[model samples]
Target: MGYVKLEIRCPKNVAIVTSADPDPVWTLDDLLSELNSLELQHGARISVSSPPKKSKMKEMANGSNKPFVMRITDDDVYESESEDESTDQRLITGTRFAFPDDYFSESDEFDDEMHEKSTPSRLMQKKSIEEGALFELESDHQLMVKEQLRSKLSSLELSQKIESENSSFAMRRLEKQAEARQELDRRLDKQYQRKIAEILDNHLSILQRNHEQRSQIEERRIRDDATLEEAKRKEKALIDEKLRQEKSKAEAEVRLNAIKQAEAQKAAQEAEIRAAKEAAEKQAARITETAVFDASKKDLTEPKGVENTRTSGNIKQGDFVTKQLGIRVIASKAALEAESNRLAIYDEVAGRINVIDQKVIDKHGRQMYKYIKQIGGTVENVRAKAHVLVQLIKDPMLPLSISLLVFANKVVSLCENPSGSFDKSAFACGWVIVLIASQVPDVMDLVLAEFHRSCIYTVPKHLQASDAASQTKDYWKMLGYREEDGKIESTNEFLNRVESCMKLYAALIQTEIVGVKNPYGLNYGWAWLAMFLNALPANRTTAVALEAFLKMAGFSLLRKYKSQFMKVLNVISRRFLPSLKQRGEAVHDIVMKLEQYLDDKIYLREPEGRQLQASSLSKFFE
Candidate 1:
């Protein structure tokens, strides 16, 4: 007897069947019963195929039986195969069986049974089989079904294990790849951070170096500035010391000269007195001798009583005449001595002034203006020279120099012909006058008078004609009054030049004495103020020319020397009121403006107000 191997296929699993004994061949009934039992256990239907009859069979006597093999395929594939002998032979040799068409229809029931079998109670119930008559009959059937179920379960377990293992391997592979990517990203990020830090450090170092360099430069600049300031301070101290020494030496010399002059004057006075006495004695002797001769002759011829009366009358008349002659002689001698002393003082003062003038010329030379132009016309150098000139002028011990007068004359000349050029020398001269007036105010009158004579009233003779055309033509030909076009300048042009000089002089006076304590009283600028007022109505432009001069002078007087304000105001008001009335609105406006300025600046009490009220100019304000 030969044994057979049978394979049964289902949707989820394949079942293999083999007979336990070789002598018992599996019949159709046995096969059907086994299939039915398998369907019940696994909850799926299965199909079986019959083997073909052979022509001859020889049973070999062997200790082990040879088994026939059978295989199962899908029913859909089996139905598609063509029916032929080769196919039948292949099917028989292959021992394959096809599942029924209802295999999938039973799959749901099969899953239910599998779920039921997984429960522990159902598995225990299935394991406990009872031994009885029915049990004996179904024992073989149950045994076959159990074998087929075991094969199906084993096949399912094998496939599930293979799938689980493959899934675990793929999951592990993906995890490794993710870890590698993370490590690479972390390394790259660290490298980038390090690079950025290096770059930042390099930039910080550069900035620090630049900051240090700038600080050093600033420190050097500060040091240089301090050095320069220290140098300037030392230089200024030296200059001030030198000026003080010079002033002291000059004062000493002046005092000594004054003492000598006084001594000489006293000696001269005594000599004059002695000569007058001797002359009177000689005249008296002559008179006495003549009288004696006459009386001797008269004594021989005339009576004693008559001669005595005649001698007494003659003596009385001669005594009266001699007394008058002696008095006249004394008066003449004193006058001569005074004149001689005056002449000597004048000569000495003139000589001292000439020496100062020579010093000035040597210090500045004719190229002073050239030097002024060289430094871009900045007045710093000019101002320094002006300060020196002012110091010279303010030297009280120095005589009123003719050189000052000469320089002033030259300045006035330049001012009158400015020709649209800045005259630094003229400015310096004006400052000199201001210093002189402030220090030794007695010179103010003289300077003002001279300025009025030489510059203000000294118009060109040709320009003085009554005929306007002739005046204009001659004005063009004059050296100091000509215009750029070779034609006569307008009145305004001429006035402009005069006004500029006046303004310069006014500025000098105003600026130089701003904080000075004027011991000379506020009468300092009175001459200039009076002169300007007197000339106010000389011509149309004269008012304009004097306008700045008047304002500055008035303000200076009102502010600096308020004590003399009323006196100055009275004098100006008296001189200006008549002219203000005649000159119409222009002059009136100018006067009114000045008046308003004064009124605004000055606060007066009843007495002062009353003084102002009494003035004729006060009426215009009213």
Candidate 2:
């Protein structure tokens, strides 16, 4: 029923640019240049956005705080390899980064070597072979030494040699045995050292001397305790004194708080009394003003069938008559005349719109334009204008509800129409209407008062009652309409009209709505308006507006509505998106569908029928 907000966590692949300038113009080349410049510095793996915008750009341009939309295209747009080089390319935001097979060829050997060496299994195999070779050499050397020692044992020699050999052999054996014994002794010594360390670490006797010293210190401390007891008592007294001071401080704070609260209460009471007196006085004044206005109105109404009358003094007869009825109001006539012309054109155009009046349209258009200017709209104005001439139509006094509707509708129509003038007056008028209209929801409760004071008709009682009934109804049957969930059904024809009106509304509101305006006008102006119309059902005219918006959006309202379609798809996606593979497949499917659709509409062979078919297809997705 109000505005819709979407929180999109743009992926790394998409670049966004948001603009606060309201209107901006830049070509595709411009956008590409900016992105290319950015890529040269920030890398291609970024999404640069202009400020958060309500819509997309008609043309690309550098925007102020505006976010520009970008996406990596490496995933798409390629077919086969080239003869000159292997055509492998990565596109970031439409700028191609080519990666040809030839480009990688020079590094192939290096890459292979690096790859092989990096493999854990391969590295381990090489290490094992080296260790095996070293072990084999050592084993061979040990075998040779054993053979030599055997030879030495078998050698025949003189008595001295044999004796010497036996003695040397025995000595060698003795040395070996001694070395073995020495090793055993060393191990035993290490064990003994470990045992000693364990005893030292675990035994309480290790600390006996230190403990005795500590005990002596404790005894001395006990002896000294008596002397310090007096000081301790004094310290306790000081602590008590500090505690007393803190207690007094806390009490004082509590008293201060109480006094402050009392003062605040007294001030509040006095303010309330003053406010009450002022309110009473204001009420009295309002009552007096109402009485005077009523008396004057009554005097005028006493006359039979009075269509319009000029007022004398402070009394004006007609509801449409402003203070100027008595005395000419001072304002710019030229600006007023321009508005008059615009309104005239609006009336003519809306005259044909069966159930709606041009005045309400105008009022709404003006209001929307005002809001646009306030938020920020382009200095340049749109070229289109809504103009219609009502032939064989009677000039009738429109009720306030109908009149307001006409006024609002006309305002919307003018903004939608490109062939219109722009001026400070147009902007100002729109601003005032929107400012006032914003207060309407709040004022709905005070409709009776507004009616009495302003002498405008209230919302039709039957319409209000019917609205209430619809709110409570589980289902209200209307043939030829489809029901989707809790929404009311309406005929396709009716929906189409609503969509059309929505387009008109969007065109008017886009400039004013935050984030939706495109200086070059590429963004869908009517998105918000379409959303608004889809949700609204207060009036048939509103339904017509919604249908208009749908048509403009190139969407069919009869079969699967765009919003509903998106909702259903989104629900399905949520179920499958938890799995990466499934999500990728889904994305692939969507991409394929879009590609096929584009090809069919743009590249099909049909000649004469192409335009019509293409147009129809465009409308389907509009």
Give the alpha-carbon lDDT of every model: 0.43, 0.34
User: Which has the greatest lDDT?
Assistant: 1
* Candidate 2 all-Cα RMSD: 55.5
The estimated TM-scores of all candidates read: 0.34, 0.16
* Candidate whose TM-score is highest: 1
Error of 2 at 248 (Å): 60
RMSD of candidates 1 onward, in order: 22.8, 55.5
CA lDDT, candidate 1, residue 451: 44
Candidate 2 Cα outliers beyond 4 Å, as residue runs: 1-403, 409-490, 512-622
What is candidate 2's lDDT per residue for 45-109, written digit by digit as tens? Answer: 22332221222221223453233233325443232112112422211112222333432454646
